[model samples]
Target: MSPFYFGWLRWIMVYNSSIRYIDDSLFIDGIDLASIVRQVSTPTYIYSLKRVGENYRRIREAFAPLAAQIHFSVKANGNLAILRSLSRAGAGFDCVSAGEIDRCLRAGAPAQDIVFAGVGKTRAEIAFAVSAGIGWFNVENLAELHYINSSADDLGVDAVKVALRLNPQVTANTHPYMATGHGAAKFGLTADVIRDILTRQSDYPRLSIAGIHIHIGSQLGDTAATLAALDAALDLLAAHPRIRTINLGGGLPVAYRAHDAQPSLGDLVSELIPRLAGYDVLLEPGRSIVADAGLLVAELLYVKRQAGQVFYIIDASMAELIRPALYDAHHEVAPLRKTDREPVVAQVVGPVCESADVLARDRELPALQAGDHVALMTAGAYGMSMASNYNARPRPAEVVVSESGDNWRVSRRRETFDDLAQSDK
Candidate 1:
């Protein structure tokens, strides 16, 4: 096969086949480049509602036999429209804070459909969650247990469903900063500690032990680490027959680069469903569900050549998307309009003051000039959620594209200078 065909096949193999080139310019679904640029403008996040639904159906079909409860992790995108889209499609939410729970509620998700997970839950946050009647609290420590119990007692509520997050000590082979299952990571409780708590379950009467939760880390491609963590949870459940649910926290990987070898959702479900035959299975998938469903479109400002390297600077910065600088993450950069010029190795950068603000290093792309539009691919997950007002750069707007790309709606408005300093004032 030719290189072009092989490359195309690789992308379709990992992500849903929604991206295509129209003439020379790239188009998402049935929408053309010029229309998106003219309508939404540049430096905006464009999400494909069709792609999100496709991903959701893919996972749902994979675990059809098991009826796994799929909770969309709010930390991935957290956009209200995106949350509402998933919620309307019959997906629950996996939240880590009161803020996230509020977002889910605003998105019209039922309180019973939300699961709260975090290493640290403040007393106020716990009280808020209790008042909201959230479904589950994946407790990480004894202190958190105390808080949940006390909060439930104060509200005069019945037993609050609790999932004990156990640290399996299984190491996921991803970035060290993203790993959460290792002994060094300050996430879940150790198995022995959880067992001791289980032994004294009567002490916290208002807290009901509903299940166990295990999350090794994010960006996990291989099944070994996740399966190992699940095995550890199953071992803990073997002695305790009362606990009926097992939550495999979200960390399914998405292909950022063409060469990424992340396993498919179908493969993961096939291997995992058999192991969780009798018990209830819950999956929290954030990145894999939405990462490829959106792209960040930015306007090219200038091109500079210095010391045998080319830098393509864009108006957007780390304040808008921080994955590249924060995690050294890879995001494919492509021109919005097709180009016939020869390809050149260039570094795509933002106008951030810090040196770590580079988006892509040593990327080969068609030669381009100023005013050209470029896109950062597979950025729907953490791109907007991690944005900040650093360097006083205003956050970009976001729009949701229809499945056919024929219609679009603005989900978030662009931030203004006044919006940035409003908190200070």
Candidate 2:
């Protein structure tokens, strides 16, 4: 491989044991991506179970000193196969809705291992979770608490474990849309409100206030804001000594670019374990665990040059992977087959009919022609989960490579035109 390709792979942080070059072609878990694309077709998602397991075990080992429970956040990627793989690996789930909880259950996760979390939990969702015997509810407001209590009471269940989500009001260094711990964000309750709730704990007799949950935001660059949020939670814990668990909501970031600065898992755990010596710890990690384990492979349709700008349009669009359009995020683009052609600076665009449909802006990539395939690196998390039927475009297929790196299968078949309107009357 050329230094350029090696540098690009390092930039995305996917140049690991599971992902590398085999005879100048990109192979994930010892299986050629081209072969998978040939079977599943273009605009497909490919995930490596080996990489997912490695990432999960890395975090689990880092927090071994604290004996923290790892709850993989389902909103990141709720595919049944992915859930089942993590469940079999001894991971619990952090679900934002009853549907996610059911997905986890259907994937073989025990009900007691799931935690229901969200700012707005519908009455039906609360009832469903309570009836399903979910282990914990990260309650954000008094209304949710009342709903959970009512649901538990109706179900003839006593002492449903609850975690009061505390809005620490700390500003984490991340995109404004992703920052949830700020005072202006509508995520968790304020300290004063939590104090009042704890003071009047007798009102909700069916609830057990067992933990304090704090999730400031996602894609956190360092531990400063997390430490600040933890300090705030500790202050609240001082007044209420009964709360034994502290659910540190997931914000651990992954390297989206070569120069992206992120906290190491070891460093983060080292700083956190001391403060949470006696308390039970729970971590909800979503992106850090699976983001780098997947890819979005799209086939180039046309190469156009207009007004001194080159655009390599592909079959995939924001409808399939919208992080670039949604968060101005970066996903390293690499050609499936290596080439010695001169590199060109061009924008990798999609077939979507919007100005924001560009996947990569002014990126240097190997010279390529129509029909050549490209892989959007680090798309395992928030890729398919956020896909939509926008522009009436059918979604793509999803394939997963086994942990052994010797086999692969299509986990989700591509959506067809008729399938798009299957729900319509």
Candidate 3:
């Protein structure tokens, strides 16, 4: 186990599980990190095709008894290579925009298997989803319902199959920005409100009231909170006989460190199956399906040491990855090449200018040097997808590794400045 120590944050590794999917460890089916760094230097987004498949299998096995339709939430990680790999493994999609919908379709997901969802969907986006014959629209409010009905009617189609995303008035013990279950949040409607809408659904002939949907939160860990939300939804589903499907929205937690007590999806499925016996089950897992399977490889540009601090600046910035900047998210940080040092106090930061662009703050880990490699662990989901183009820095490139398979393919190439300014004209 690799022990890391810092003033405030230190990863005490009980077991040092080797980084997979990239060239970090020497294994029967692992890419060599030194080789990759030799080719693509620091700030590269590395994905493990093999681990992605394992994650999909884990979810599939979890909901095996029920006809679990696993929809990979694209908002987390929307790389075409990753999407195509999961699609080939029988994964559907939960999309939030027309561009995502189009990307899913291009990645080989059938329109009938995709679910379109978002709060502020535009008219053109609505038209585009309908035109694609998407299976369902997760309507967030009454106005969207009206817009969808009008759009479907204009397209001369039958009522579009839809699910009302229920905002279960419960507190998911997570960050406020990521939590959607709280009653006061603006994501979904309450039970009483959904009931009101169901009564009014009769007025809109172009809308098919098909299912009940609610996403409690993102990156949740407490079993009790998740089960409570599921039980609450089950109670509502049992009371309302018309609802044909029940979507226990995504947000299962993934392990950032090897010792993190992340529950198996099987445990969750086993506990919730009894309550959800008859209804068709829909699992919209985003993070659990891709988090561990990916890694963010950064090259150590320069290592500075002062009185009591060290700064390991890498090529990647918050503009290339936003979880650190947005949620103050914690991803395990480690030196790629083994180094000799008891431990040193250091901060793992990026090249971005903002003070909030910190990745790992106050940590004690082995010494790093210029041209060394460090990895940001548990970054598959929401890592690449949440990237921005701040500071005029182009996003980093992404690649995937598989066992006895393709080593690395450019999932997304870092854009050139000319490419960025091309659309301005």
Number of colliding residue pairs in each model? 0, 0, 10
lDDT of each: 0.87, 0.90, 0.79
Model 3 misplacement above 4 A: 1-28, 403-406
Q: What is the lDDT of residue 394 in candidate 2?
A: 90
* Best candidate (score: lDDT): 2
Judged by whole-model lDDT over C-alpha atoms, candidate 3 comes out at 0.79
Query: Which of the two, 1 or 3, has more TM-score?
Result: 1
Candidate 1 residue lDDT tens string, 1-425? 54444433333222346766667667777776557788768789989888888888887787787899999999999988889989999999999999999999999999999999998889999999999999999999889998888989999987899999999999998988889999989999999999999999998999898899998999985889999999999999899988889999989888887566545777778788788888898889999889999889998899999999999999877888899898999998878876657677799999989999898999777688999998898999999999998988889899888766577878898888999889994
Which tens-of-lDDT digit does each residue in 14-132 have in candidate 3?
22232533333422135566677667766778877777787788778878888789999999899998888888888889999999999999999889989998888999999999989
TM-score of model 3 vs. true structure = 0.92
Candidate 3 or 1, higher lDDT = 1
Model 2 worst lDDT window (10 residues): 7-16
Worst 10 residues of 1 by lDDT: 6-15
lDDT score, residue 146, model 3?
A: 85
Across residues 1-425, which tens digit of lDDT does each residue of candidate 2 receive?
Answer: 76666644543324656776677788998898999888789899999999999999989999999999999999999988889999999999999998999999999999999999998899999999999998899999888888888888999999899999999999999988889999999999999999999999889999998999999999997789999999999998898888899999998899876355534888888898789999999999999988989989999999999989899999999999999999999998888887778677889999989999989999988789999999998899999999999999898899989988899999989999999888999
Q: Which pairs of residues have clashing backbones in candidate 1?
A: none
Look at candidate 2 and tell me the lDDT of residue 304: 98
Better of 2 and 3 by lDDT: 2
